[model samples]
Target: MPTLTRRIRRTAATAVAVAVAAGSALTLTGTAPAHAHTGPRAATSSTVTSAQLTAGLYQSAYSERNRVLWATSAVGRPPVTRSSLLKVDPGTLQVQAAYTPPVTDAATGAVEAVYGIAVDDEHNTVWTTNTRNDTVAVYSQRDGRHLATLPGVAHAREIVVDERRNLAWASSFGDGTVVAFDTRTYKEKKRVTVAGTQPAGLALNERTGTVYAADLGGDRIVEVSPYAKEPRLIPTGDGPISVALSADGRTAYTADQAAGALSVVDLRKGAVTRTVPTGAGALSVAADRRSGNVLVANRAAGHVTVVDPRKGAVVETLATGANPNHVTIVRGTAFVMDKSAVGPERQDQAHRIRVGR
Candidate 1:
C-alpha cells in the first residue's frame, strides 16, 4: 500500500474518509446512540458502559503502578492546534486532569499534538507520539507535567515501554523504523529499521526484550530483538494495523484492518495459524491475560469483538461507539477509546467493559 493510503486507513479520527475508502457502508449521523451488537454467546449490555470524554481521542494506556488511565487526543487535521493529555480514573471513567502540549508555533497555534500513548510504570512517566511533529513526548504520570520532547522520529505512531529493561520503544510509520530510548536518561539508545514497512502498533515481550511491530503497509509483523543485527518478518493477514501477544507470549494476535479479521500467529513457528473475521475495519486489539481472550476494536463496524483464541471464534461483539480506535486491557477489564462519528454532535467516548468469559 502507498504511504498516503496507509495513513488514511490508520487514522480513525478521520472516520468518513476511512469508512468510505474501506467500504464500511456506515450511516454515520448525529444523535445516533451507540448500541451493543451481540453474537449468540455475546456479553450482555450490562457488561459494557460508556462515558463521553472528549473529541479526537485516539489511544489509552493503563498505569498499573498508579491505577490510572492515561489517554491522548489531537483535535482536527494537519496543523493540529489543539491537543490534550488526559489523566482518567479507570474505575469511574472520569477525566481527572488534562494537560496541553507545548506550543510549537505561536502564529499558527500549533502545539505538539499527541495521538498514541503508553504508560511507563517503572519510570513513573507517560510516553506519547507526536505524529505531526515527528517526535515523542514524555509527561509525568502523577501530575501530567511535560517532561521532555525527543525529536528525529518519522511519523511516530505507537509506543511500548519495557519496565524491566528501563527502555521505551516507539514505531516510526513514515520511515519504517523502531527507535529505542533509555527511560532514565531520556535519550535515544538504538534505531532498528524494518525495510519497506510502515510499523504502526507495537508490543513488547518483557521477558526477552523483543519488540513486535504491526506493519500496516507490509501486511506482516516485524520482530526486533536487541541482539539481532536485523529484524525478522512474520507474514500476517491483510493490513495488520495493531498487534498483541498472548499471556504466555507463545502466540501473536493482529487486527487485520483491510481484511477485517484477526490473524493469530504462533510465535515459535512464526506463521499465522488462523484468520478469524472480526468486523469492518478491524483496527486495534488487546489480549486479556486473565481470561485468555482477545479483544479487537472494529473501527468501521462501530464495535469491539471479543474473540476466544481457543475456539478461534468471535464470542461477543460489544458496541463501544463510532470509530473505536484502540483497546487496552488491565486486570481483565477492557478500556476502549473511540473517536467522534461523522457528525457535529458526535463526540469521542471511553468505554469500560468487564470482558467475562
Candidate 2:
C-alpha cells in the first residue's frame, strides 16, 4: 500500500474543476449537544470559491499580517525532489506567487520532500516540515527565501507555531514524538515523546500555551507539554489524521478519518464529548475563531461541513472542490486544501470560502 502522502499526492493528479458554492447557515432544532451535528445541510452563511493550484497540494498556513495564504505542494517519490510553495490571495482565490523550498540536504546534498507548513507573522517567517531529511526550514514570508534549516526531526508530518509561547512544534510520525523549538533563537528546546504515539497533525493555542497533537498511530490526541511532565493522551477514534483547537484552548476538534466523524474533544477533561458522523474520509478540521464554527473536510463526500455553535449542531454543508483534505480559517474566510481524486481530468485546487461575520 502506498503511504498516505503518496496516495494523496497521486490523487491530486486526476483532479477535476468544481463549482464553489456559498455556504448556507444551518439550524438544528433537535437537542443542543456539543456534537449534535448528526445530518448534513446547515444554515449556511458562507460563500465558497476555489482556484486551481500547483499540483501535489498538501497543507496550508495563513499570514494574517500579509492577508495571504501559504500552501505546500509535493511531487516525486521517496526522497521527494520537487515541491512548490504557493502564496495565494484569500479574497480572490488566486495564486499570487509560487516558490520551491530548498529540499536538498545541506550537508550531504540529498533529495528531500516537504510536508506541513506554518506562518509566524510575528517573526515574518514561514516554516515547512522537510519530511525526507527530518528537518524544518524557515523562509522569509515576503520573498519566500530560505533563511535557515533545522534538521533532525524524524518524519515530520505537521507543524504549528505559537508566537505567544515563542515556540514551534512539529509532529514526528516515525519516532512517535513532538519536537519543540525556540522560534526566536532557532534552537531545539525539547522533544516530547509519549508511548505508542505517532503524532500526525498539530494545533496550538498560544494564548494558553497549549498544543494538541493528533496521534494517528495511537488513535488519540496527545496534549504535549514542552514546559514539563508527560504528554496527556486523549483517546479518540480509529484514525485521527488532523486536529483543530478552539481559540480559547478549551475545546478541540478532529477529523477522525477511520471513524468517519468529526469528534469534539474537551481539552480541559481530555475526553471526547461528541462524535458527529461526517462521512468516510474526513481528513482535516479548522475552527472559525470569529463565529466559533468547526469546519470539517469530507474528502470522500466532496463537501465541507460547518459545525456551528448554534445548538452545537451541524448547520450547513458547503460544496467544495473534490477531496478537501485540509482547511484553515483567517478572519471570516476559510482556506481549504481541496483537491480532486485520481482521474483523467484533475482539478486539484486551493479553495477559499467566505463566511459572514
> What digit string (tens of lDDT, one per residue) describes model 2 on residues 1-357?
124424433543332222232332211112221222234343445666655666678888977556567888876575566577877765555676777766366554334456699988777788889887778888888898878889878888889988766788988888888888888899999888777778998888766677888988778998876564777888877799899988788888888888878888887787888888776798888988878878888898888778863345667677776778788876566778866633233436766677543
Steric overlap count per candidate: 0, 19
lDDT of 1 by residue, 224-295 (tens): 988788889999999999999998888999999999999999988989999999999999999988788899
The deviation in Å at residue 96 for candidate 1 is 0.9
Highest TM-score among the candidates is held by which one? 1
Those runs of model 2 whose alpha carbons end farther than 4 Å from true positions after fitting are 1-41, 103-111, 226-228, 309-312, 341-347
Each candidate structure's TM-score, on Cα atoms with residue i matched to residue i, is 0.87, 0.83
lDDT of 1: 0.84
In model 1, what lDDT does residue 47 have? 70
Local lDDT at 48 for model 2: 65
Candidate 1: misplaced stretches above 4 Å? 1-46, 341-346
